[model samples]
Target: MTDHSLYVLLRKLEDAKIPFTLARDRPDTIRVTMHLVGERTEIDVFDDGHMEVSRFCGAEDIVGDEALVDRLIQENRD
Candidate 1:
């Protein structure tokens, strides 16, 4: 994702009142964790503008470039 897109995503998450933690996983990757009811969804942003999301307790990894944070949040809501 581009910088603008990432910024917009972050703002949208904030505006939606989702609680999350942002951290640097490496020099080229930034990780964001959205805390849900019983599980946490993670978004990893790479330097090349790529992003992937995975649930903390999920058995499969969700990887893609499309913006899917909203859907992920909706799925884990209490």
Candidate 2:
């Protein structure tokens, strides 16, 4: 089975009630788009664990630091 870690990560967004979608495709190449509080953006994560973050708006308005975002994105299965 494919690792459920990413799917699990996506599920956390559900409790937050953030809208998202999962498709059957190569993950690293998959494009994810999101709008957080009217800010438009997209993020594509690479195989090396690096992400390309783009924001049409609202990047500057993010609260806290990168560490917070990292913590939120990490899905702990233990």
Candidate 3:
């Protein structure tokens, strides 16, 4: 969570009714527990929602599109 990237992401998630947990105490961590894209997976929405918790060093390995991330985040919202 870098300067309201969390806020923006959170807004999206909350809008779509997606399930997510927010920990502002940790800037590098955003925890989300839910089934997304396919199977059950946990994702750590990072700056611009570019990180995934399921994969190791996912930032370098996995790339999450902004729109998809926004939509995904939104999906978990209310």
Candidate with maximal TM-score = 1
What TM-score do all the candidates reach, one by one?
Answer: 0.62, 0.44, 0.36
Name the runs in model 1 displaced over 4 angstroms.
1-3, 58-78
Question: After TM-score superposition, what is the CA distance of residue 45 in candidate 2 from its true location, in Å?
Answer: 1.8
Q: Which ten residues in a row have the lowest lDDT in candidate 2?
A: 1-10
Across 1-78, the per-residue lDDT of candidate 1 in tens digits comes to 545545766887899999989998689778888987668888887776688989876434557544587777788999
Give the per-residue lDDT of model 2 (tens digit) for 5-59. Answer: 4444455667778775533346465545665766755656455545566777644
C-alpha RMSD between model 2 and the true structure: 14.4
Give a tens-digit lDDT track for model 3, residues 1-78: 545555666677788887655544367677665434444445676656575656332233356678889999888997
- For all predictions, the C-alpha RMSD in Å is 13.9, 14.4, 14.9
Model 2: per-residue Cα lDDT at residue 62? 52
Clashing residue pairs in candidate 3 (N, C-alpha, C atoms within 3 angstroms): 13-73, 13-77, 16-77, 17-76, 17-77, 17-78, 18-76, 18-77, 19-76
How high is the lDDT of residue 19 in model 3?
Answer: 69
Predicted model with the maximum lDDT: 1
lDDT of 1 at 39: 82
Shift in Å, residue 47, candidate 1? 1.7
